[model samples]
Target: MSTLTKSNHIGRKISRIRELKDMKQEALAQALGLSQQSISNIENSETIDDERLIDIAKVLGVSVEALKNFSEDSVINYFNNFYDESAKGQILNNSCSNLTFNPLDKLIEAYEENKKLYERLVQAEKDKVEFLEKILKDK
Candidate 1:
């Protein structure tokens, strides 16, 4: 393939993988410690540095070679060649449909719990300050 074609292919593959992972470009940028613009440039097939490519691959949990050379057939072939029936069964068993609660719902619940705990901590700190002031006044 031409360099431009390869670059575009890589960009599309990255975009697809990012979507499958349910990540935005900004989120992927944050994970890779890169700017959103850099991610945008990458998705546009602009030149990217080798280190950044490695970082992207790491973030996407794939090899740099895979990122560079992936085609739809290769992906399908990979699943066909590497995935066993037992592994497929395990994947299904651990799939999102088997989950009791949506992951986002769990995250929101945890966030609310953390917010309430922080508020209680702040109130306790204020009460402690008031108690200390009263003790000093009585000294």
Candidate 2:
């Protein structure tokens, strides 16, 4: 397949999976550390990089290969299961008819928290390495 066609195929699959999960583009963008426009571009088959594809796969809890090669029927089937499970989880979590928070909202909050934690951890590791280097230099 041509590169554009391949990218379009992947984009369509990503879009389908995101919709299946009842996730907004903004939420996916946050999970992927990308802008909403970037997600839009990918969905519209504009341009996307391999790193972005990997990130999308990671956020969607799917394999990169699966995201890249998912057939339409398979995607639809997966979406049905995904929606059913999410609905069940929601019902279990909230006994009342009213929901205090939307699932996507909670997901975005969790993703943002995780992203911040990761950044902090990375900074701490870098600082530790720098400190070790300085101590060695002093010795």
Candidate 3:
């Protein structure tokens, strides 16, 4: 049987790293201030610019060199070494409870954004009211 050789694909590396970190496309998109469709397009791309690559590395919590030199073997070895108990025939209970980023942090960020937006909207309304009141007084 013939074996399939993979190309040196940077997109695949980013995708794999993202998956290993248990991050969804939407989360990565949010962190990068990009759309989920943009993330998907990036993953489907074979190459990325250096500056953007740096941003992606920062978001993924890895160095640019690490992304360039990413390999399945290295990742597998890392995991194998991480869970030493797994070598002893113990089943690993990998659960969703083990999230890379804190949910509370995201919630707080959302709350702060919403608060700022609401404040802006309220101020705009107040300005409109004040302008109308001045017009009525003039009339």
Best by TM-score: 3
| Local accuracy of candidate 3 as per-residue lDDT tens digits, 32-91 | 889999999999989999999999999998899999999898988978776887878887
**lDDT per prediction?**
0.77, 0.80, 0.90
Better of 1 and 3 by lDDT: 3
lDDT of 1 by residue, 1-139 (tens): 6656554456777877787778999989867667999788788774457887888988886788878776767767766755675665653344555655577996897698679879999999999999999999999
Candidate 1, position 116, lDDT: 86
Listed in order, each prediction's TM-score against the native is 0.49, 0.50, 0.61
Clashes of each: 0, 0, 0
The lDDT leader among the candidates is 3
Q: Once model 3 is optimally superposed onto the true structure by TM-score, how far is the C-alpha of residue 106 displaced, in angstroms?
A: 8.5
Give the C-alpha miss distance for residue 63 in model 1, angstroms.
1.1
TM-score of 2: 0.50
**104: Cα error in model 3, Å:** 9.3
